[model samples]
Target: MAEVEAADFETAIAECGFGLFNVFILISSVPCLTAMVFSAATLSYVMPSAECDLKLSLLDRGMLNAATYAGMIFSAIPWGFIADTMGRRVVLICGGWLDGFFVLCAAFSQDFLQLMVFKFIDGLIICGPFAVVVSYLAEFHGKKHRAYVMLFVGLSVSVGAMILPLMAYCLLPVHIFFNVGQLQFHTWQIFIAITSLPSLLSGFLHMFLPESPKFLMSQGNYNKALISLQRIYALNNRKSRDSYPVKKLTDATPDRSDVINNPNPRRSRQERYKLAKKKFCDGLMQLRPMCSSPFLGLSIQVYCLHFCQIMCVNSVRLWLPQIFATMHTFRIRGMNDTSMCAVMDHNTHGRPIDTKSMEEECDIHQDPDMYIDNIVVAAVGLAGFILIFPFLRIAIVANHILKVFLFLSTFLVGGLYFSKTTLTTLILSSIYLTMMGVCATTIISMSVVIFPTLMRTMVLLLIMTFGRLGSVVGNVLLPIFMQISCIAPFLWLCTLMTIAFTISLFLKVDVQQSLN
Candidate 1:
């Protein structure tokens, strides 16, 4: 038998060429983005509303927030492992379907307990596609374009953040009734239900998309990898003149090559599985190595950076609606006094006035209906924010700058609340939208590029797991702050941002001009 040379991974990919489905990839990210916004917006504020509607204690509400991200933190790593072990396509599609189902479950929850259970499950299931899809996007692009495309993914998330609130704003205005009783549905419920549509679409689209060729190559399926590459080329509308070049695979010398003997290839599939398992075990056993000098220093650097970011964001997002609700109340009270004063002025000027009767007039402006109209505040803020992120970069230094901007806005919101001025509240809310959109994109985009390719998925899993844990704490921390004073949460956010800003200056390594 003649000896055959192995294929080259990189050259094979290069010759096969990049795909034109960058738009598809962008579209694919819509579900992940939309799901996060849907989950975050709903989970954050649902606590207060649950207290309002179902009359649950604040402790129970806090439990729900904790439960939701507990699910997220637990599910992220396992899903990443599955995506690596199985394939990205199947896991992504499942994520979409699960998202829609769980969201609907949340919408129909009869009580806080039911809502908590369903939401936790939804959090676990829906987030499978989140980091996995980002990993796929990274895998598809060449080194030169990786950051650029990931930026697009980041941008898509911002667009989702904008759109999610708008959808909630629209769905929240109407009332729904049932035979048992008139059940009033709020904007949050509607937001959760409608946001699931994007996930559904993503699930459908993933049916046609190819599996990751890189994954296939890792598994030692060169022919399968080639076929996957062909699909990618076709999707991109590039001519598949040559299959994913085999030469690069031979040159790169994938780990699987060692399993089959060139000089010592005799391992069976069982042995290879054992070897892979051993590597996984080794990674775990080397906990000390993971924290050793350079590794520990780098990990600490990224961890603190992400920790501060997530912690501040979690608290802010959870309390924003409550803050807005207070602002709306202030606005209504001001409008009422202003109207009353005008009426008194007119009566004093010889106009006919029934002062006793006027005092009996009911002001429905303070009612829940008032809340429906003001959903646009969140909607407008989100939309305006989505439009502003494309021109921004994921600079670490800028991350803190954005946080500072958010803090200043938070100060404005605090001031307005204290001073009881509606205009200041409105202005602060506008700035809040812009700051959130920018901060979100910057964090995700920057995180995606900073890690190396081999550890990319693992590192992302680590980032999200811990980052979201912080988010979970932040969400629950709302009630803790509320116990002291309403302003405490914002004050904490300000402090967290100040810390993050200091860290960003030293921690961020600019990867924009540098290629991996």
Candidate 2:
């Protein structure tokens, strides 16, 4: 009798049937994505109230803001390598727990140096799940639903951003202070702790989820991969595993054996050490394919786009709390006829000193309007993501959408620079930031489609590494640029967005021809 050939991965996955399990996967992803946003962004909200506690100067604030990105930039590749070599599930679970732990540690930090160290470590651990989760989620879905699922992940991110300001509104204004021995606990500290719960919860949720069947197949674990698909089928379709239509998965790499399932209980120390060394070297070797041939050009374009988009978006996004606070100060002083630069200038060099007052210099009271403004901005971004979700299904629409958003963002950035009223500045800035954010997610979705499964996580991490590097640079430079001249940072961002838009134009060919 002739042997039966197994179904291909995509075909097998599609047979798993998208229902309860698919929805569970998407629901489970919310906290993981939300944790990434909160870990990176919570510091922006914390800094305003924490300045007095940490005794932060402008340089200190910039460094603190950049610290998490610095950690992510350094660690992204290693996490990617681990995910590619091992499995995505372990990486996500372990990373989430460790990230949450570091965030909790940050909450207890008593000084600037301690908090800085913890925040950096938080970034290092969080990068694991942040870079891997999207790839992990995409592996489960068929090509038809993959792009939409990734965009939904992006929408979850915007939800996380919206949650941030609401949390800040409820927590940052509260007056809480106490001393536990040498440690001083404040409302900001409590806020940090609260923000960390999502990472922990995400880790907990992953414990119940199955490994990515696509990742299993990539490692030549055909039997285990088929079993995984069956499990997915059982959960998603509410049927017995025997009912799964795909009996087996086609062996993509027949030469490679299943490294994950066949574990030896007892091995000599020397043998174990040698095995570890070989796997590490093999992981390093995985980078070669991405750096050469067809992938190299696509990698470069997406990486540059990620860098520029993140640089512009984060440079403004991370400083929004401070900027809003500045506006509050301006309004307090009855300044009506002022641009953003004028308000900045007034806050910097024109404030009248009230030496007669005997009140504490550190005012942690955030006005209600600041939080409302932030919520409004986040809500606008969220709405944009929802509105654009349906159009993503159209052919070539993602590419066109990217170009339009980038061009609009560039124009909005320039307009933001010239706006003389608070409402005008807020509206332009909101649209600009939202558009850039949407473009960023669109780029990630495109990358997921363009790259092969073998090097997908590696490519994403490399792209994200560039993006975080841009963020670190932007966060550090924006402050210095503002001090030099307000327009310098805006002009710099405008130039970068223009360049990104141009680079995006070259990506059409690769995007149109993607295998996914």
All models: lDDT? 0.59, 0.82
Span of ten consecutive residues with least summed lDDT in model 1: 357-366
Tens-digit per-residue lDDT, 188-293, candidate 1 = 5655567667777778878767777776665555556666666665666555525323433542324554443343467788988898798676444424444566
> Lowest-scoring 10 consecutive residues by lDDT in candidate 2?
356-365
RMSD (Å) per prediction: 8.0, 2.5
| Model 2 Cα lDDT, one tens digit per residue, 224-343 | 778888889899888898888776567546724455567787989999999999888877776788878888988999899989989888988888777776676667657676687886
Q: How many backbone clashes does candidate 1 have?
A: 14
- Cα lDDT of candidate 1 equals 0.59
Candidate 2: deviation at residue 354, Å?
7.5
TM-score of each: 0.76, 0.95
- Model 2 Cα displacement at 56 (Å)? 1.8
